[model samples]
Target: MSKTITNIHTIDLVSDFKEITKMRLAVSVVFSSVAGYFLGAEIIDFVEVLLLAVGGYMMVGASNAFNQVIEKDLDALMNRTKNRPIPSGRMSVNKALLIGSTLGALGLIILYYINPITSMFGAISIFLYVSVYTPLKTKTPLSVFVGAFPGAIPFMLGWVAATGSFSIEAGTLFMIQFFWQFPHFWALGWWLYDDYKRGGFFMLPTGKRDKGTAVQIILYTIWTIAVSLIPVFGVTGRLYLTPVSGVLILILGLGMLYYAYKLYQSRDEISAKKLMFASVSYITLLQIIYVLDKYIRIWI
Candidate 1:
């Protein structure tokens, strides 16, 4: 009986860790970094990629843990976040802080081994997310704009990790992800406006779901699609995409734009949800296509 009890306790601890760190979200963020690494790497190093993935995941996990610690009370007021580890009382704030700090230090150490620039960007991402974006959520709708700084870093972070320097290629990657976040997050904000209000978060640009917010989402969607095609024009240096790949990317963008337009026309919760999913799919598939096109071009 004691052994069974111990096993159950261990499982519960693991589950709490996953919840506190938001493991799925961390993995997706790590995927973006890996894609960027592949894009910048002339000769792929599997070991370096492995290090990047582990270190990236740790940093993202640390950010999520710290975010939960800072917003424990506010999270408890929102149904969507109320059951998270810290807010739900499954984990203590001190424990979460310890996890966050340890993960952050270890992540930075690992990234430093890859390159100092990578480590610096990793630290900056954590600081901005924890210090700036987290506190700004309740103060203004521009918090999303502030949050995009760190949110856009992962893809470019990977490139810097591979190249050990910033250049137009890295800047282009950053711009693509930066603009992409506006539409993606605005759609999520639209869907969760009421829930976010429960936590005093002014997430929407207009602080309410209206034509103004929808129009901005549409505008940013167009900008994101346009920025994504910049590589095709051969101006982004090493990041140039072939015309075929560019066309494919444009098609994917159009699909997301279609959903964005639908949300504008409907202005309903269901439409917002669809746009949210479409945006997620759009970014993930875009990264995949970029990586695939890079390798295919090399082989040919």
Candidate 2:
């Protein structure tokens, strides 16, 4: 009976860890970094990629854990987040903080082994997410703008990890992801506006569902599509995309834009939800397309 009880306790602890760290989100962030690493690497190093994935996941996990610790009370007020480890009383704040700090330190140390620049960016991402964006969420709608900086870093962080330096290629990757976040997050904000309000989060640009917010989402969606195509023009250095790849990307962007337009026309929760899912699919597919196009071009 004692052994069975111990096994159940272990499983619960693992579940709590996953909840606090937001495992799926962390893995997605790691995926972006890996995608960037592949794009930047001339000769793939599986070991290095492995290190990048683990370090990136740790950094993202740490950021999430710290975020939950800081927003425990606020999270409790929102139905979507109320059941999270910290807010649900499945984990204590002190324990979460300790895990966050440990993961953060270990992540940075691993990144440092990759390169100082990579480590520096990891630290910057954590600081912006935990210190700046987290606090600004309740204060202003611009918090999304602030949060985008950290959110976009993962893709470029992978490039730096591979190249051990910064360049236009890395910057272009950063810009693409940075602009992409505006539309993606705004769609989510629109869909969750009421829930976010309960937590005092001003996520929407206009702080409510209105023509103004929809218009901005449309505008940013256009900008994201434009920035994504910049590589096709051959100006982004090593990040140039072929015309064929560019056309494919354009089509994907148009699909997302179609949903963005639908949201504008309908201005309803269903439309917002559609836009949110479209944006997620758009970015994920875009990254995959970019990586696939690069390899195909190389093969040809």
Candidate 3:
């Protein structure tokens, strides 16, 4: 009976740990990092890719844990976040802080072994997410802008990890992800606008579900579409896409834009939700296409 009880306790701890770090989200971030590594790799290093995945997840997880710790009170006020580890009372603040700090240190150490630039960006991402973005959520809509900086780093981080250089290629990748976040996050803000308001978070551009907010989403979606095609123009050194890939990317972007337009036309949650899903599908497909294009060019 005591052994069973111990096993149950261990299971609960593991569950709460996953909840604290939002592992699903962390895994998505790691995917972007790994994709970036593959894009920049001259000769793919499978072991280093594994290290990047682990380290990337750790840093993103640590940032998420710290964000939860800081937003415990705000999180409790929102149904969407009320059941998170800290807010739900499954974990204490002290425990979360310890976990976050340890994960962050370990993640940076691992990345440092890959390259200092990669580790430096990893540290910056955590600091920006925890120290800057979390607090700014309730203060101003500008938080999204501030948050975009760190959010944009993962793709470039993978490149830096593999190449150990920060150049036009990395910058192009960063900008692609950077602009993509506006529509992605704004669509989320639209869907969760009410819940976020309950937590005193002004995440939307106009601070309300209005045309102004929709307009900004449309504008950013357009910008995202534009930047994604830059590689095809050879503006990004070491990064070039074929005309065929460019056409596919444009079609994908237009699909996202179509949803963005629908959201603008209705300014309703249903439209917002569609846009949100579209954004997710857009980024995921875009990244996959990018990686495939890299190898395709080599093979052909």
Q: Each candidate: what lDDT? A: 0.94, 0.93, 0.94
Task: Provide the clashing-pair count of each candidate structure.
Answer: 0, 0, 0
lDDT of 2 by residue, 255-278 (tens): 999999999999998999999898
Pick the winner on lDDT between candidates 2 and 3: 3
lDDT of 3 by residue, 1-300 (tens): 999999999999999999888988899899999999999999999989999999999999899989999999999999999998888888999999999999999999999999999999999999999999999999999999999999999999999999998999999999999999999999999998899999999889889899999999999999999999999988788988877899999999999999999999999999999999999999889999999999998998
* Least accurate 10 contiguous residues by lDDT in model 1: 84-93
lDDT of 1 by residue, 1-300 (tens): 999999999999999988888999899899999999999999889999999999999999999999999999999999999999888888989999999999999999999999999999999999999999999999999999999999999999899989999899999999999999999999999998899999999889998999999999999999999999999999989998989989999999999999999999999989999999999998999999999999998898
The TM-score, computed over Cα atoms with residue i paired to residue i, of candidate 2 is 0.98
Worst 10 residues of 3 by lDDT: 234-243
Per-candidate TM vs. native?
0.99, 0.98, 0.98
- Candidate 2 residue runs with Cα over 4 Å from true position: none
